[model samples]
Target: MSPLNMFSRLKNRKSSATASQHGSLPPIDKPMPSQCVSSPPVLPAATMHVKQSLQPAAVMQPKPATAAAPKPGSTDTVRSVVVHAKKLGSGAYGAVHLGTCYSTDGSVHCVAVKVISAERMRLESLSREASILKRLSRAGHPSAVRFYGWFSPGSKKVSTDATGPELTNLEVSHCLVMDRLSGGELFEYVLARKGLSEREAAPFLRQIAEGLAHAHSLGVAHRDLKLENVLISASPSGDDICKVCDFGLAYRYEVDGSGKVLKGRPLTETCGSKSYAAPEVLEGRGYDGFDADVWSCGICLFAMLAGFFPLDEATGADWRFERVKLATQHRQSATRTIFSFYDRPCQLSSQVVDMIDGMILVQPNRRLKTEDVLQSMWVIDDTIKADYADEYMYDEAPRYRGQAGSFDPNAVSGYGGQQDMAPLYRGAPAGVIAAPPPLMKQLAVLGQ
Candidate 1:
C-alpha cells in the first residue's frame, strides 16, 4: 500500500472511533488495512528533568573552555565572564561576558552574566522574560535556559563618578545572570558551514525537535522559535544538548474542563521576528502560540535546508518588509502570502517537504504538531544518528585575547560583530505580559 492509502485508512479508523464515541457509526466506503508504524515517544512528565549530558548527534565534541563562571554579585558577572581572556560581549538592553568563578572553598565553575538596564526591566516584554526565566528555572525545563537569578549591582551604594551619568553609578543597573550556552546560536554554526547538506542538517534538526518535544510535554510554547533564539548547548554530544533559549516570548497553557480554549495570560501584542511568523498570525486571525511555534520550526527547517526566509519575496526591494513590519507591530493584522519566498527551487526530499508543507499550513487547524514533525520520514533514517559520529561539534572561531581587569570593546565577538550590542533604547514596559493578538486568542498549538 502507498503512504497516502495508509494515511487515509488511519484517518478513516480515527473518524470511525469518533463516531462510535458519539453513539453512532458513520460508515466508511471501504475497509482499511491495519498497520503498525511507530511513533516517537511522548515527552516525559512535567516534573521530570532531562539528563544533562543529552547533546545533538551532529556535534562531535565539547566547545572550547573559554566560557566563564558567574561572578559573586558583580555587574560583570554575566556580562563579562572571562575564564582566561576577555570573552566578553553585549546585546540590546544588556552586556555579556565570559568568566570563571572560583568559590571560597576552592570549587570552580563557568557561567555567563547578562546586564540589563533597570529602565528596560520596567518594560512589560523584558519583565515577562524575567518572569519566564524564573518560572522555567523553577520548573527545571530542560529545553529552557538555566537562569541563575537577577541582581542589581548599583542599587546598594550610590557611587556615581565615571564622568557620565550613564557610566557613573553602575550599581543602579539590574542584571540577569543566566547559564550561557557556549555553543552560541545554531544559525552561526549552520552559516559557518556555508549552509548544510540534507545529510548534515537532519541530525541537527532532530536535536532541536527533541528539545521542543520536551517543552511541549511540559505545556510550554516557545513562540519565538527562530534560529537566533535556538542556542546550541556547550556539550560534546550535540543531538540531546540543544537549548531552546529566550522563553521571554513563550507562554504556558492550562486546559479547562471543556478542553476547548486555553486559559492563561492572553498575549495582546504579536511577538517574534516577522519572517518566521505563522500564516494565521499574519492574517490577523486568532492563533495559538504552540501552533505558531511549530510553524516557525518548520520555517527554521526550511531555512536550514534552503538558506532563506520561507515567506520572503523573490525579487523586490523591501516588498515584504512593510507587510512584515505591520504584521509584527499591529498584533491583529498579519498579512497572508500564497507561497514560500525562495530564490531557487525547493530541494528537500519528498517526505521532508511533505512535513514542511504540513507545518506551513495557513490554517492553524491543519498544521502539524511537534510530535508529528518529529516523526517525519527523514527523522526515522538510521544514517542521521550514525552520521553524528563524524561532525565537528566545537569549531571555535578566532580568539579575542585581552588584558585582565581592563575593558576592551574591540576584542570580543558580539552577536552581529565587534561592538554589535543591542542599542540602548527605551522598550516596552516591564512586569506586564501583553495579551496575545486576536488571532492568537485561543491556545491553538498546545495539542499538536
Candidate 2:
C-alpha cells in the first residue's frame, strides 16, 4: 500500500488533527518543468517494518468545475486583480482564490488572493496573522512564505467558492496578496513521493528548523506546525525546499517570567492538532508555545523518515501514544530508549529515534529545542553544518557575530542560539540559560 493508504490506516480514519480545516482547491494548470521539485532518490526500506518505496505518486486531481461558470458579466475584481473561481483553500481567516494580478509595471502575475470578510471571520485574528506574515516577509527569511502585502478592499465583491451563492459575491473587508506557490502543501508532496528517505528528509528538516528558529527569534511561535502547513517551493537553483506557512495560531508571546524565557508564558488556550499537540498544551496547564512547537516538529520528522505516523493521537488513551511515553520515561536516556512503534517494530537508525525522543517527551521542560534538533546526526550534514553553532536567526542585517567572546552567545544572539529561551520573550543575553547557578561554586553544584 502507498503511504497515503498506510497513513489512513494509522489514523484509523480520523480526520487529520489540524488547527484549521483547509478546503481543497480546484486544480490549476501545472507549472513548467523548471518549477517541479525533482523526486528524491528511492532508498531501500526492506529492513524496516513498512514499505518505504511507495510507487505511483498520488496527485490531487481537481474535480470538474461544477460551480457556476465564470462569466464575462461577473465583476469578480478585487482591487486590480481578477479573482477566478479556482480556490486554493479556505479557513476562518479568509477564502483564498487563484487570481491574475495586473501590475503597475504591466507585468501579469499569478497570485493567491486571501479575502477576509469582517462578518464571516474575526478581523483581529486575521490582522494578527497578516502582520506576522508581513514582518517575516520583510525579514526575507527564505523558509517562511513571502507576503506581497494586504489592503482593505472597500465593498469589493469576491467569490467565496464556485459552488454556492451564499459564498459568492462576498463583500471583501480586506484582502491579502501572496506568492502563488506552484508546489502545494508538503502533505500532498509526501503523498506523491510516498515517503522520503532519511537523506531526502534531512534537507527539508533543516529548512524547517531555519523557519522555526527565525520565527522563534522574532517572538512568533507557529502553534500549528503540521505537514499541512508546510509547502514545497522550487529554488532559483531548481532544488525543492520546504517553506513554513500558516501562522493563524502563531503566538506573539510573553517573555517576562524567569521560567517563561526557557519555555514561554504558560499558554492558556490549548491549540494545535491533537496528533501533534504537546501533552502540556493538551492538558491546558499553562504550557509554553515554543516547547509545543518542537513537539509538532518531531511528528513532522517521523512522517518523513518513517513514512507513517508514530501515533494516532498523542494522548494516553491511544496504546501507541502510551507506548512512546513508556519508552521515554523508562529508558535511561535518549540514546537507550527504543520504541515498539505503532503497528510495526521500528527499524529507523538509533540516532533519529533519539532525536525524536528528545523532542516528543511528555514533559515540556525537557523537550529539545530547534537547535538541539539541528544537532542531530540524522538532520545535520556538511550542507547545514555551519548552522550547528550559527545564530543567523537572531542576527540583524549585515552583522555576523555568533562567535565566542566574554559573553554567552545565546543571550547575545537574542534566543536564537539556545533550544529554550523565553518567547514573547526574546533570547536572553548570552549563556544565561546555560550559565551555572549564581552564588554556587562549580564543585558544590556538582555535589562536591
Candidate 3:
C-alpha cells in the first residue's frame, strides 16, 4: 500500500479505539511470536541495579522502591509499575499514561508507560525499538529517553461462555516504560510562544543535534524525528533539558559481528510523518536514512523559529518536491523567497540561514550531517555567547511564558500572507516566484 494510505489506516485504527479503557487489555505475559523472541535481547535487568552506571552521578536518580534483591532467574523484577488511568497521549500503535514504579523495598519512581495491544504489534519494529533504547540507555546519552524496560504478559487460554473447545486465548498487551516528561511536547511549547527567536531556540536545537549525533554515531536512524516526539524535562532551577523519545520507528542500519553499531545499509521505506519527510523520501525512492533525518531536523528548526512549517502540504500537490526543484533551479531566489516568509525581514542571521540551507539541501549527499550541524558557526556562536542563558537555564513555566492569560493564537500576525499564491510556481525557469500557502492549514491537518 502507499505510505499515505497505510499511515491513514493506522491513524484511524488508533483514533477509533475506546478511550475509557485506554490501556486496559489482557496481559501479554506469554511468549511473544518467534520473530520478537529472536530479536536482539535487551540489557539484563541486573544492569539496572547499578544506578551510577545508568546516568551521571550528578543527575538525581529515581528513588528506589525496596531493599530486597530479586530471585535469580525469576520474572525480571526490580520494580512494580502501575499505569494510571489518566491518558498522557495516544498514537498509531498505542497509548501512554502517567505511571509510577515501586522498588521492592518501597521507593517510587515516576514513569510513562506506552501500552500496545497484541493486535497492533508491529513485533519486529517494536523489538528493534526496545533494543535501540537499551543501547542508548547503556551509552548514557543525556538527550535520549531512559529505557527502564518493557513487559509482555504470558499467553493464557480463556473460555467464552464456558463451553467451546476451551481454546480462546486472551490477546496480550505490551508495555514500554520510560521517564515521564512533565514539560510536554515541543511543538505545543513553541506554538504557545507564537514563535521562538533564534537565540531562544538555539539551546534546544543544540540538545536535539547532540542526541541525533549520538544516535547516528551508533548507526541508528530515528525515522520519525518531529516536534511531538521531543519531550522536555524541567529541572527545579527551571532549565529545560531535551529528551528525544518514541523509538518505535527507529532503524539500526549498521552493527559489528558482536552486534555493535557500524555504518550499514541504505533504507527504502517511505515512512515517517509526511510534513517533515525529506524530498527524496517523499519521492518514494530509496534514500539515505541519516540524511533524511537531517532534513527533518531542518524542518523542525524552521518551525521552532517561524512558528509554522516551512513547506506545508497545502502549498500544492508535491509541494516540498516542487519547492526543492525550484530551489535547485534558482538557489538565491529561492532563499530570498523563504526568507520573506519570516515575521521580520532580516531577522534570521546569515549563519542560521546557511546552516538551514545545508541541512535542507535537495541532494541528500550534499546535506549537512548531524556532526557538521553541531560544528556550524551559528551553533558554535550560540553555545559560546549563551546570550539566551536566562531563557534556557531559568524561565519558570517556560512553555507558558507567552501563552498565559493574554495570549491569542488567532491574533498572531506576520503569517498566512502567502495563502493566496495559487499555482505556487510558474514555468519561468530563470527565477519563478510565488508565495507558498499559510502554515495554519498544516497545523490544522496535524491536529486532526
Candidate 4:
C-alpha cells in the first residue's frame, strides 16, 4: 500500500513539471496570487481563459495598437520615455544623456534627456523652461534650441546615466527631452577655431541677435547667456546656426500687450555667469534684464572677434573690468577702454567698437536694446538674416508627415495637455550665421 501511494505521488509531480516546461504558467483553474494588480501591465497568457466555443475568433485575440484602439499607457498616451544610452554633459543639478524615444506614430528618434534632481533644483525650474520653450517652439524659432517634453520618473531605481543628489521621493526626474544639438557647444566651437574673423563672426552674432530679439519680443530674458549655454546646430541648408539653450535661469518679464518688456519694474535677481553679468547685476542692484542681456551680447561679440574674453569678470575687483568701468564712467570710447588691457589686440573696426560700447555701457538707462541689436551695423547692414525655422514641436511623435508653410498652433505640444517635445530634422536654415554644420536640418526656412 505504501509503495503504491509513493509511486502515484512521484508520477503526478513529474507530469506537472513537464506541462510547465513549455512555459512558466499556473494551471487554468489556479492562477497565481500576483495576477491581481490592475494598474501595472500583466501577461496576456496569464489573463487568457478558454472562451465559449461559439464565440467569434476576433474576441479571442488581442487587437493591434493604433489610434483607433490603443491599450492603456500606450504610445498614444503622454509618456516620459527615455532609453539611456550615453552621457552627454552634466551640471550642478544633474546630467544630460542621449536617449531613444518611441513616438506615437511608431517612429523612433534620438532625444537629449536632461536628468535633474528635485533636491538640487525645483520642479518649477524645469516647468518654467518647458513653458518658455513651448512658446518659442510654437513659433519655430530657428535661433533657439527646441525643447521636448519633461518628465519626473518617480522610480526608486537609479537610472544607468542618472547622476545628481540622491533621489528625493525615491525617484529621479528628467528635466526635459530635447533635440540633440549635434554641432556641440558654442565655447567648444569657437575654441576649436581659436576665434573667428569679423566677417566669419558676424553671421553668428546676427543669428544670436535674431534669437534674442524673438525672446525679447516675447518678454523673456535669458539670464544665463554664456558661450557654454549656446549651442551650434546645422539647418537643412548645411550651414551651422547658433541656437540659444539652457533656459533654467531664464526670466519672464512683465510685458505690454505687444510682448515687449515694460520699463520701471526692474529685475532684482543677480543671476548669470559672472563674466557675462552686467555691472548692475554684480553690484546687486535692480536692473532691466533686457538691458543686461544686451551687455552680455556685447561681451560675446568681443570674445568671438578677438578669440579671447574681453575681461575675466565684469566686477570692479577684476582690474581689467575696472579699467573698462573707469573708462565707461569717464565717457571714454569703447576702443581705448576695452583694448587698453591687451598688449596687442586685433584690429576691430570702429563699427564693431561702437556696437560693443552701445550695449556694454556702464549705465543700464542707456544700454542697447535687443531690437536695436538686429539693426546694428553688422547685422541689418550684413547680408544675412535669420529666417523662421518651423517644425511640429508638440506632436505625440515626430511629425515626419511634412508640414509646409506657417506653423499650425493646432499641432503644438501645448495642445491636448501634451508635454513639449520636437525631433531634430534637416530643415532649410536661413538668416545670419554660418559654421561647420551639425544635427537636424529639419527647420523650415520661412520668408526666405
The candidate that achieves the highest lDDT relative to the unseen native structure: 3
Candidate 1, residues 77-172: lDDT per residue as tens digits? Answer: 232322222334544454555545434455555666555566644544455555556656666766667675555555331122234333332455
Worst 10 residues of 3 by lDDT: 43-52
The window of 10 residues in a row where model 2 has the poorest summed lDDT is 439-448
lDDT (0-100) at residue 328 of candidate 1?
26
TM-score of each: 0.56, 0.62, 0.66, 0.63
Candidate 3: tens digits of C-alpha lDDT, residues 59-99: 44323112232221132433566666667887655678777
| Candidate 4 to truth, TM | 0.63
Report per-prediction Cα RMSD to one decimal: 18.7, 22.9, 18.7, 32.3
- Candidate 3's TM-score: 0.66
lDDT, candidate 4, 304-416, per-residue tens: 65544555456655545555554555455554444433223225554455566676777777776776566554554443221111111122211211132223334432322
Q: What's the ranking of the predictions by TM-score, best on top? A: 3, 4, 2, 1
For candidate 2, lDDT tens digit of each residue in 13-44?
A: 23221111112222224322221111111111
RMSD of 1: 18.7
lDDT of 3: 0.55
